[model samples]
Target: MPHPQAKIHRMFELVEPIATVTFSEVVNEAFLSLGMRNYWDGYFAGRAAPLGLAPAEVVHAVFYNFADGEVARHIPWVWGKVTPQEALAVRERASAVALRQQIGEVAESPGLVRVADLATRAAMSAPTEGRALYAGLKALDVPEDPVAKLWHAATLLREYRGDGHNAALVAHGIGGTEAHVLMALALGMQAETFGRIHHLPKAQLAAVVDGLRERGLVDAAGEFTDAGRETKQRIEALTDELAAPAYDVLIADELDELIAGLEPIAASISND
Candidate 1:
């Protein structure tokens, strides 16, 4: 059976282009960091149906506010200072930059991959898979940032064995970081790459390793402990169970229709 959450996530994917484009607009206008925008956009978009915001409204808010001077100050130019034409031009340029950056970030961030994989698994699992994944996440006893909490859960579930390394590495590269850096060390990246990709120094990576070790999640050599391995497995299993239902619902016919509808915009964005 496909997991409820997995189905839900795939359903969400049907709307990802809309959400992602909205997010790009918001981040570019508000001057919010790429990380912060990704975190909020994912959380909000995922929960939008339950939370009562039209997905388009969420995107609108970011741009409107940025133009109105209501948020972050790092955007290239203040919204009010620019003419309407200039704003449009800037938004277009920024949108292009944001998409490429996001792809790169997704390629590099191990925590991101871990979360995505588990989410994929949870979606494949059962109706109860999302709840179970959330419960496991709660048990981690981490900080309150939802994004960070999600990352911790992903870290706990990641399959760090040698065979899994290549897929993990590819995900990191897409996000624009070294695979070993994010997965093994549980640290933010440091090296600066296209978009917002940053590469971490060796010492900083070691510090992350130490932090994971201190939490009993890993050993001195940065390998996951027995407890970590077990937890990760459980989460992955639950995600897998959640995804089953979604896989079935996402039948070939429906997917074909969705692709037909989405292809134009998706292709335009990619080409831009």
Candidate 2:
């Protein structure tokens, strides 16, 4: 049997959009309500607001995947546009609005309440050590609205896993750009797609690819070699292992129910 952590990790994959979807109309309008014009500004400020105006370099480290200058370009300046408390409130409201629209009346269903409870239990159970973003989010009170509560629960769990993933990457000696390259190659995404997202210049990107080649993680064809696949799998396994503690509060049946109950809800938003 797969490890229980692996099952929870797969469930996370299906439900992740609940926390990560940034392009929907409701989310956009909500960010605009904060008087934020640029998407990145809202993104950085809203996500990092939980850290209470952390320095740009600190945000860059905790975020752990953007290019060097990318995070620094936004951080403290974004705070000037919106206070951390205001940003946090807007984010919660925006998430609630979007979830309610997508989920409709089912947002308050008893079944959803139970799922939210299970997820919140797990989120609350997770330790704050080395999980800065998760720790920050957990410091706030959960929303009183059921739908917002669910969204908050999922967001907390997402950041919890994210912090663990970053730890695994750092432990493996992977730089942010290199990690992106490995993930793109492992998942069959275009390397340039990640390059554009991270603002990496072609020469720098080529150097990263070359370094991976030297390490036998990629071949001349730029596909994952056997070693590359194993390395990716190992990192993922470690991430799941680290994330497992959150779900430890759930019994086997409860874990199963959590995943099942979340499927339709996640499907609702994913198909929207």
Candidate 3:
């Protein structure tokens, strides 16, 4: 088998996107139920179950994901009607539809049968806090397809990790744009990706960059300053620490097996 660290990295490369993309269908459908077209409508509505929280409370649960100003701008609008329970129910129902569609689209291929067992194995080995957090989430009443079950579990665990990361960001005094800016500098990610992912106004994003620069976390060119780098590492470390609970279930071989199995499927998904 591959070395443990290599396996872990590959597992992330393979599993992360699947966890992210498949779940988008559920979140997307939930927003569509509200008859909205804007990205924010989908984003907010989908995550209104942020950590399985109510809409009034979800903002706090997802504090680090949206800037104080950005969240403030949109959350009040969202909370006027939707509750956390409502959003959660929407996500649960939408997820079953999404799973059937995705599975049917791929099941004809040989990869579907193979990937599901491996993916489920990986998810089963994730942190217990993350796994246990799933207790509160609405389950997708999927058909007797193992692949669908794995996909649903992986998606829920990803959401759990995200909620934990958001909590870390909040505790560290970082908010939406600032967290993105810091991550961009530390990870060498494009600043533009942040705007696209979060739907931040250009001016608002720039303003946050300016604020981070003032705090000595980033330089004039939007690179990490020495202090910024240190802070970034700490934040990342903390996030991993928070996320580690889920990964702790696996031994090295189990992780390697999961990664190796998923790599081909990840490739297949990417090609299509």
Please give each candidate's TM-score.
0.30, 0.94, 0.70
Backbone clashes in candidate 3 total 4
Model 2 worst lDDT window (10 residues): 190-199
Estimate, for each residue in 179-256, the C-alpha lDDT of model 2 and write its tens digit. 999988876876877544446787888888899999998899888999988989999989989988888888888888
Off by over 4 Å in 3: 1-9, 22-34, 50-53, 69-135, 138-144, 167-172, 186-193, 196-203
After superposing candidate 2 on the true structure, give the runs of residues whose Cα lies further than 4 Å from its correct spot.
1-3, 195-199
Q: Any runs in candidate 1 off by more than 4 Å, and if so which?
A: 1-16, 26-202, 209-244
Q: Name the top lDDT candidate.
A: 2
- Please give, for residues 72-91, the per-residue lDDT of candidate 3 as tens digits: 45555654556656765565
**RMSD to the native, candidate 3?**
4.6
For model 1, residues 1-272, the per-residue Cα lDDT tens digits are 33354433343443344324534554444333323243333323222212122234332332221122222322322323433333333333444455445444432445434433333333333232223222322333342332333323222222111112333323322111223323333332222221222234556545645664676656665566786555444543443443334345454554444334434434444454
Report the number of backbone clashes for model 1: 43
Clashes of each: 43, 0, 4
**Best by TM-score, which number?**
2
